[model samples]
Target: MPTYAIGDIQGCELELQRLLERLKFDPAADRLWFTGDLVNRGPGSLGVLRLVHSLDACAIVVLGNHDLHLLALAAGNERHARKSTLDEVLSAPDRDELLHWLRHRPLLHHDAAKGYTLIHAGLAPQWTLGVAQTLARELEETLRGAHWQDFLLAMYGDQPERWRPDLTGIERLRFITNALTRLRYCTTDGALALKEKRPLASAPKGLVPWFQCPGRKSRDARIIFGHWSALGYWDQDNVWGIDSGCLWGGNLTAVRVRKSKPIEPVHLPCEGYLTPGESGD
Candidate 1:
């Protein structure tokens, strides 16, 4: 029962299929974990959604910023859909069902038995595993509640850049959302630099990759995340980043997670869909 944690698909259904074939995946015995961004910015958003949604029993997904944007668009937030490639999904006959499933997907998943935690992006430097899980559930409940659309409408923003226990209302939720889905770099003090998406070598002064922040509370736990394709495949500092920029013609990557053995990563080259620098999450 091998579990594979895959990088951001970004709507690359064909690449996903090829990679699964390469892994010799047996859905009944193998579990697939996606770091999210399962849709948007590629040619096959609809197909990708259908395929993953069909494998609900064995597939685990955390929501990426792009995934949230897709939900927002479906909830009538059209202004942000200018560059979106989700029309096919929106118009599909099963659109509601797919979105419903997506809406219920988690923001974070932790398997204590496997000793691994999964998230779409970075966590606040101040969060321990328990804190991260609690915050995740807070937003998860809101997304699953009756007013989820209202939450979506108010979800866009970068304010309240730092996390605080006393934070309340939308401010608290937005911070939680950004930290879990949009975070990459931040000051050691935990102030998110969400606009800085470049690789580590080019990171601006005073900013460090969230996982690398000194004395990070979650540093002792193994975390798997994506949403930083610019950082490529990272495997250091108690974290693994597998988003290899598949949407930008880079390889789609996956790593086999084992309880006691070294993890192994596999990659499949992707045909260029959108060139680098056109846009990013």
Candidate 2:
């Protein structure tokens, strides 16, 4: 089957439709691997959610930071509710269904057959592919279980910036969540530099994009990720980043992923909804 890994939609439904059309996507035969951030910042998060959810088995999505923010707001986090463009989703007639669907989404996806791992952001420098899978499942099952709301409430911190095998409870989960869905730059020793959202050339002292750290354990694995719009559709070494800043009037991108073929991005330009410096979700 033909599979397309798409960049962060960020609620750009019109552009998403256009991009799919450009790819000549057939839901019946082709599969879509969405790079998360399906809602927020754009003009049509509600529309985008309904469309993607309706696709059912044709699409697979890993949760993004913005997606988690929507869940936090739905779970009564007033802080996120204030500046969010997620009002449409929160007030939709099908709101519960949508949020329920979103919460159950994975933090990471790995296809052993294709030798590709899909995450909303980059992996930790210390995690091997096997450890990454185990940690992803720990969080995945928590999100899908009865203690989910409790987990959501505890999932927001940036503490324990570096992963330690000795870390336990929510602290461990939080670190894993940040690494998988929110990471960008990290220090050489793998400390999370979550606040450094600048472009690569402007990287703060001692920090490098997660994928560039020397001797990283997952360096040999093929990774497809989103969430660093500043990096913008990067393809380097074994990593491919497809988030092209659609909300900032950049392109909505998609790349064909196959075991044998070369990967190339197909983009649809967006009539940006948020100006630079605005909150994305």
Angstrom error at residue 70, model 2 = 0.7
Per-residue alpha-carbon lDDT of candidate 1 for residues 98-195, written as tens digits (9 for 90 to 100):
99999999999998888999999999998999999999999999999999999899898889998899999999999999999999999877798988
Candidate 2: 10-residue stretch with minimal lDDT: 75-84
Model 2 residue 86 lDDT? 90
Candidate 2 lDDT score relative to the true structure: 0.89
Off by over 4 Å in 1: none
List per-candidate RMSD values in Å: 0.8, 1.1
Give the per-residue lDDT of model 2 (tens digit) for 1-281. Answer: 78999999988999999999999999889999998999887889999999999989899999999898888887766665667789989889999998889888888889888789999998899999889999999988888888888877777878989889999999999999899989999998879888778888888889899999877899999999999888888888799999999889889999999877788789888889888777632
- Error of model 1, residue 122, in angstroms: 0.6
Residue-pair clash count for candidate 1: 0
TM-score of each predicted structure versus truth: 0.98, 0.97
Candidate with best lDDT: 1
